[model samples]
Target: MILHGIGLVLLAVVTGTLSVLLAMALIRWWDAGRGTRGMQLPQGLDSSLKPMVLLYRDQRLVDATAPARALLDRLSVPEDEWARLLQWIGPRFPEAMEGLARIDRSGRFECLGQSGTGSATLRLLVEQVDSGLLRITITDPQAEYAGIVVDSMSQQAMEEELDLLRRSLDQTPMLVWRQDAEERVTWANAAYLRKAEGQTDEPIGWPLPRLLDSPRPVPGAGTRTRRASLNQNGAVFWYDCHSHPVGDQVMMFALPADAAVRAERSLREFVQTLTKTFADLPIGLAIFDRQRHLQLFNPALIDLTNLPTGFLTARPTLFDLLDKLRELRMVPEPKDFRSWRQQMSNLESSAATGHHVEEWSLPGGQTYRVTGRPHPDGAVAFLFEDITSEMSLTRKFRAELTLGHAILDNLGEAVAVFAPGGQVVMSNRAFRDLWPGADSLGHALACWQNQPETGPGVDALGARLTQPDADLRDSGLMASPQGQLLGWSVARLTGGRQMVRFRLPDPAQQGGSQPLLAASAG
Candidate 1:
C-alpha cells in the first residue's frame, strides 16, 4: 500500500507539472498569435501593397496606389483643384486607376509629385525596395517639354492668322503688298500687278529705286521727283513713290499724276467742232474752280492766254498768273486783277441764283463782256461776247438806207412791199413797166410769181439752182428791151424782206463784170 501511494503522488506531481508546462506553451502560442499578454497589436500591417501619398508644393493627398495618386499629383494641382482634377482625369484616363492598382499588386509603385509650378513633367521615383512592400518611385519629365507644346500651339495660330491676312489683302481693291525683313518682295495683290492702262507687264515687287526712276521716254524736266519713277501709258500714271522702313524692309505706294487724264484727242475734236459751229463767238470760254484757278480753256482762251498746258503747275494761283500777265504786258496791273477778282467773287456768289455778266478791259486795246455762271458743283463757267461786229453792222445799215430807197424807185424790176402780215402795199416801176395792162398796188404777186412755170425765163432758171446747200434764186433768163439777157438772183433778208437783182449771164464773155449773187428773199 505504501509503494502504490508513493507512485500515485509521483504521478500527480508529474501530471501537475506537465499541465503547467502545457498551459504555459498554449499561453505562449496565443501571445505569439494575438500578441503578448501585455503587448499591443500594430496599427498597420507590413504588406506588399500600401496606399500612396500625393504631394504638391504644400498639398498632400492619400489615395490608391502610387501611380494613381502619382498622376494626380504630377499635375501639380492646388488643393482646391483636387476634386476638379480627379473629376477631369478620371473620365479622360479611365484605365489610370487600373494601372496604379497593378503597380500595387506587382509590389512596385512609382511616386509622383510636382517638381515646379506649372510644369508638365511628373516626378517619379521608387520609394520602397521590396517587391511586395508597395514599392514607390518618382516620375518626372523635363520642364522644356511643356514649353515645346506651348510654342507649337502658338506657331500654329500665328500661321493661320498670317494666311488669313494674306487672303484679305489679296481680295482688297486697293493695291497691297508685303516685303520681308530683307526688303525682298514677299507678296503682292493681283491689282498691284495688273496693267492699269493696258500695259502687258505686271508691276509689283519692283526695286525701291527702280520704281521711282523716270522711264526712258519721260522728259527730264517734267519729272517732279528723283526718288520716284514716272511711267505713263495713256490714262495710267504713277507718282510720289516713296519708301519707308518697316521692320528690316521698305514699303512704298504711289499713284500716277495722269490717273485723271483721258485721251486729249476727244477734247481736241470737241474744240474744233465749237470753232466751226459758232464762228462769230469772238470771246473765249473757260472754266475755273471755286478758288478761281483755271481748270479748262477753250480754243479761244488758249489763243488769248498763249499759255501751255503746264500753266496749271507753273501758275498755281490766279494771283501768280496775274503777276505773270502784268510782267508780260498781258494784263493792266495787280490792282486791276484784285478788283477783277473781287467782282468775280461777287458774280460767282450771285451766279448760284442766276447768271451774271460784267464788262472788263483787257491789257490789249480791247474790252470783253464777260458772263459768268455757276456749274453744278463748285466750278464757275465764263463766256465772253465781243460786240464789235454788231456795232459795225448797225453803222453800215444806216449808211445803206438812203441808197436803198433810190435804187428801189427807178429799177425796172418787179418790187413789192408787205407788212409783217404779208399784205402787199405797193409795186415798183418795174412792175408797172412789165404789167402795164392791169395789176395795181395791193395785188398779191403770188398770182404770177408763184406760178413761174408759165414763163420760159423762170423754167430755165430752176435748173441752175439744183445744187445741194444752195438757195433757189432765179426762174430763168429773159431779154430786156436793150436786147441784153438778164439772169435774176433772189434771197431772203433777216427781217420779212426779200430782194431780187437782175444781171447778164456769162457777162465775162460779153466783156462785162460778173453780176453778184445777190441776197434775195428778204
Candidate 2:
C-alpha cells in the first residue's frame, strides 16, 4: 500500500508539472498570435489609428500628427504652414475654408473631396477645439492600409528630391534668398550664407545679412534685375541681382557680373581712344551704319562739310546729312533734285559693295576726293580729302611742258633729247620732219650713218653723245644725200641728259660760213 501510494504521488506530481508546462506553452502561442493580429489590423481600424490631424491657432500651426506633418513636408511653397495646407486642400475641397468657419457654431463639419476617376476619395473633417483653435482631420478610406510601406516609399522619393534641390542650391555660384512680406529673410542658399559670413567675422545667425541692397517695394510679377556691388576682403565684386515675387514673399538671385563689367569698361575706353584719334585727323571721316544712320563722325568732317556741331551730334541719317551738305553748297550741284537723289542712292549702293571713289568740284574752286570703303556688318566709311592745290600744281606743270614743246617746234633747228640710258626722251615736230621714223637714239644714229656724204664727223658726234662724262659741248657739220648742209651740235643738260640740234645753214648765212671753209683749208 505504501509503494502504491508513493507511485501515485510521483505520478500526480509529474502530471501537475506537465500540466503547468502545457499551460505556459498555450499562453505563449496565444500571445504571439495576438501580437501578429495587432500588427495587421483591419483597414478601417488602421485608418482610424493613423489619422492625419492638424491643430491650428489663429492660422498658425500649433500641433500636427505624424501623418499630417508628412503630408505638409511634400508641399513646396513660400507661405506659412497653415497657408500651405489651405492651398493644397483648397483645390481638392473648394468649400474647406467655409466649412471651417462654420465649425464654431456647427461644432463639426465634413467635406468630401471632388470626385474624380482613378483617384482615391478624400475626407476632410474640421472641428472647433475652442474659440480660437481648430482641429482638422484628413482621411482617405479608399486607400489600402499599407502601414509603413507606402509611407517609406513616399518619404524616400521626397527625400531624394529634397536632397537634389539642396545640393543644387548649395553648389550654384549664384546667391539665392527668400524674404517674407515684411522683408525679413526666411531662407537662403549656401552661397548666400557664405557671403553673409564673409561680410562679418561673427557666426551668421537668423535673418541672413543683406548682401545686396535691392530697391524698396520690390517689383511684383515679372523679374526685375539691377546691378549691385559688394566689397569683400577689400575687393569690389559686382553682381546682377534679379528679384521675382512669389505670393507675398520675394525670391532673389544674384549672378556674378565682374567679367561683363570689365568688358564694358574696356569697350568704352577703346571708343574714347578712337574718338580722340579721329578728332585730330585732317581727312573728314564719316561712318554710317547698316540702316544708313550716321553713327560716328569727326571734327574734320564738320570743318570740311561746314555742318553745324549740333546737327552732327544729333545723329542724322545718311540722306539728311547729304541734304545738309547740299544746302551748304558743299556738294557738287546736280541738274535737278531727282537726279541728285538717284545719284546719292547709287553712291550708297556702290559704297556698300566695295571700294568706290568720286571727285566733287565745288563752285568755290575747291576739289574734294571722296573715298568710300566697306566696313564690317554692312557699314560704310567715307573719307573726304581736299586736292585743289594738287590739281592746280599739276595743271601748271603741264602748261609749262606744252610751252616748252611749242618753242622747240617753232625753231629752225630739229632738236632731240636723249636720256642717260641713250633712250629718246622727247622730240619736237621739226625733228620728226627731219628724221622720219627716228623714234630712238639708235635709230637716229643709223639714219645719220646712211647719209651719202656722212664721214668721221658723224661718228665723232655719235661718240660724244654716247660716252659718259664727255665734253660739255660739241659741234660738227654734215651733208645729206640731197647735198643739204646740216650743222649739228650736242650740248649737255641737267640730270645727265644730252640735247642734239640739227640746223640747215641758211643760204643768206652761207657767206658767213666761208670762215668755216677757210678754217677747214688751214
Candidate 3:
C-alpha cells in the first residue's frame, strides 16, 4: 500500500509539469502569430527587411506589411480583403495559378504580371512557409530577366503593332540595320540588302566593314551620324547613316543618297564650265548672293570695274562694289551720296522682279550698258558692256550730218535732193524761195511734179531719175508763168539720189541763158 501511494504522488507531480510546458508552448505560438521577430520561417523569411505579403494555402490573402500593401495598390490589386484580391489576381494573371502549382511542388517560385494597358508590371516571388502560408516577396526588376511583364491577353494586339512597325521599317526606301557593339551586322532590312547589289550572299552576322568595298570603322558614340560610299556591282552609291544605341546593340538607319551626290557633282561641273566660258567672254559678269555679297566675278569684271580680283574675292557687298566702282571712275557718279544706298536697294528690288537695265554714262566719256538679272535662290547677276565705240560712232555721224547742212546752206542755186523712194530728202533755202511749195525739205517728189508735164525736159529727167541704167544727165528749160524760161538739170548722185538744180536768168542774158541751156542739154 505504501509503494502504490508513492507512484501516485510522482504521477501527479509529472502531470503538473506537463501542463505548465504545454501552456508555455501555446504562448510562444501566439507571439509568433503576432509577428515575433525572433521566430524564423521555413523560407528564411526577411519579412522585416523587405515588403512581403502572406497568403493562406487556400489562395486567400492574409497579412501584408505597409509597403506590401502600397505595392499591391500600385499593381491595382484589391487589398480590402483576401477573397477580392484572389479574384482580381487570378483573372489578370492566369499563370499565377500555374505558378502556385510550381510553388506547391517546388517550395519556391516566381510570378510575373502586367497591367491591362501594359504600363505597370509586378514581379512576385512566392515561397512556401513553415506555417503552411505562401510568403510572396516583391523583388526588384533587375533580378533575372530584365523586362516588363505584360498580360498575354493583349499579346495579339502587341504582336500586331510590332508587325506593323516591322513592315513600316521594311517597306521604307531607306536602309535599316541592327548591329552589335563590335559593328557586326545582325540584321538588315530589304532596302539595305538591295543596296548591297547582290555582291554578297547574305550579310547577316558579318562585320559591317565587309559589306562595302572600302568599309570604314563605325562612328564612335560622339559622332552617331556619318556619310559613306559603297561600290555595288561596279556602280557607286552614297549613304547617310544615323545610329541609336540600345544597351549593347545599335540601331542603324541609313538612306540612299546617290541622287544628292550626283546632283552635287553635276552642279560643280556646270559651275566649272560656266567659269571657263565667262573667262573668255568680253562682257563683265558678276554674281551676288542674297546677302548681296559678291560670290563670283569674271576676269572681265575685274578689268571693266578696275577692282582687284583679291578684293572681289574677299566678298564685297553690292553697295561696297558700286562704291568701289565709283571711286575708280568706272561707274557714273551719284548726285546724292547719302541716297546711293537707297538706290542700291531699289536696284535689287527691281532686279529680283525681272531685269533692270540702264546706261551709265560716266564723266570720262565712257558709257556702260549694265543689265541686272535675277537668278534662282535669290541671287542677282550683273552684265556690263562697254559701249564707247558705239557712242563715238553715233557722235561722228551726227557731226557729219551737221556739216552737210552747213555746206548746203551756203549754196546760191536752187537745189533739191531726192531719195531712191522718190522722197525729197533735202533742199537748199534758195530752192524753197524759188519754188513756192515744192521740195521744202520734207516733201516727196510728187509734191513738186507739175502734172506730168510733156516737155522734152520733163521726159528726159524722168527717165534718168527712175531708170536704174539710164543716162546720168538731163538738162532743159521749162516755160515759167510769165512766158520766160527757167533752166533745170538733174544728175545722179553717189547714193541712188538725184540732185536737181534750177537756174534763173537775168533779163539781159535771158537769150544767152536759153542757148546755154540747149547746149547743156545736148
User: Which candidate leads the pack in TM-score?
Assistant: 2
For candidate 2, write residues 401-476 as lDDT tens digits.
Answer: 9999999889998999999877889999988888887877788889888975565567777788878476533887
Residue range 85-193, candidate 3, lDDT tens digits = 5565675466777877667678887776654333335566778995468886654344324433432323433664677788998899987877776667788887776
lDDT of each: 0.49, 0.82, 0.70
What's the best-to-worst order under lDDT?
Answer: 2, 3, 1
Error of 3 at 401 (Å): 3.1
Q: What is candidate 1's lDDT per residue for 1-522, written digit by digit as tens?
A: 999999999999999999999999999898798755456534443221233334322222333443355445545655554464555334434544555556545544443442222333344333333433333333234532332223221233356567778787666554444455554555555555553323445543354222233222123333232223335465435454434445554454444434323345567788888667544455676666767677656556545555555774442454565455456554434366668567545756775456887655556654556677788667777675555456567669877975676687676566544333444445566655543532422233333345322345544343332231255544445443333446555445445544444553344444322211221211
Give all TM-scores, in the order shown.
0.31, 0.55, 0.54
Model 2 weakest 10-residue run by lDDT:
147-156
Residue-level error in angstroms, candidate 3, position 41: 28
Which regions in candidate 1 have their CA more than 4 angstroms from the true location?
A: 1-163, 169-245, 251-369, 375-386, 398-522
For each candidate, C-alpha RMSD in Å? 21.4, 20.1, 14.6
